[model samples]
Target: MAEAFTIRYIQPLWFIWVIIAVYIVFYAVFNHTEINVGAYWFAVITIAYILISAFVNPRDEMYASIIGMPLGILWAMYERKIDSYFEIGFLRKEIVAIVAFVILFIGRLTLSVVGFDNQLFQSVLRNIITIAFIVPLIELLKKVKIQKRFLIWLGTISYEIYIIHPFILYFFEKETTEGKQVGNLEIVLWTIGLTLLLSSVLQIVQDNLVRKVKL
Candidate 1:
């Protein structure tokens, strides 16, 4: 929020100082309140940014591009409250998820073929894909008795898997491809195995660092 607003006041040194002074006053005033002072600051600042961007800023295009991100953040924060709202249709949820993904894949291919990059069109399509796939998948998982925490743990290391996967694949390409012929299925299994192993190691290292910080 501050970053979005900073460009306007960057050149005026006094204005920047005034913002700092206001923050100091805000903290001092809120220090006696019941809620965490930081949460108040965050909510105030985020709302300020959204209002200014939507009403004050003349660039509707920029606002259009950025509004989805904050809405997504808000949705995630209140996801548990709205889990039941995603129940969509008569079709089985897993089948619906698969069909949504296949349609999304075809849409992407069509985009590539036609080279479509209209911002508004892509933004609408992105939200449609999220609604078509993720919302249904959540409902389906509930119906199938899948543990939600399983997804939570995987989400934790998803970034690590992405980071370490390329190195793992490179090693497999170097070692396995030269020594012997391997099927695509074998290569995929090997990649997943090594990626999981390395991601777990990375998580362990982070846990240790966090523990040390607390100590």
Candidate 2:
């Protein structure tokens, strides 16, 4: 049982936990500072992920959870390794997503406790947590047949939705800041509405594009 758990839950990239720990240390120190070193480090890491992904063959590292989830399926299909698809089950998919969300939420709450304005913290926390969890959860959920379809959509045209969401929030924040008092319910409703509308619009656009391109 122990060996099975180890083989299933543990992947080759366990060292990433150490990397993330270091990042969290820097993030804690720099989150509200003028130096913005955390953001710079984030940019560097993003660049590295993009570069590393390009060089690695899609087969060997396919089952790595988080960003590797969807890539694994693609690699499996590419390499005809469908029989070994059980390798991905090692990850308790929702557990990791939940943990990531909790970490981000606590991080933001810590920032608030340290003297950042409540309004600012509330304004940014939801969106930031969503993004932080997206990639972390995607790899696990993507391995499931049903969620694979949804996540592939997210993976494909994600940039458009990501960029557009901030502007959408900016407009909403402007309205609230101008005169409209944003109650808790109002904020909740706005988030639900914005997420649904934007997600639907992006899905439709992606579907149309896929059909046009014969993908």
Question: Highest lDDT: which candidate?
Answer: 1
Which residue pairs overlap in candidate 2's backbone? 69-139
Q: How far off is residue 190 in model 2, in Å?
A: 1.9
Error of 2 at 183 (Å): 2.4
Q: Report the C-alpha lDDT of model 2 over 10-31, residue by residue, as the tens digit.
A: 3333333423333344344344
What are the runs in model 1 whose C-alpha is more than 4 Å off?
1-72, 87-112, 115-131, 147-159, 174-190, 204-215
RMSD of each: 12.3, 18.7
Task: Please report, in order, the local distance difference test score of every candidate based on alpha carbons.
Answer: 0.58, 0.51
Off by over 4 Å in 2: 1-164
Give residue 84's error in model 1 in angstroms: 3.9
Over the stretch 122-170, how does candidate 1's per-residue lDDT look in tens digits? 6556656765666666666667754688677787798567557766666
Q: Which ten residues in a row are the worst by lDDT in model 2?
A: 60-69
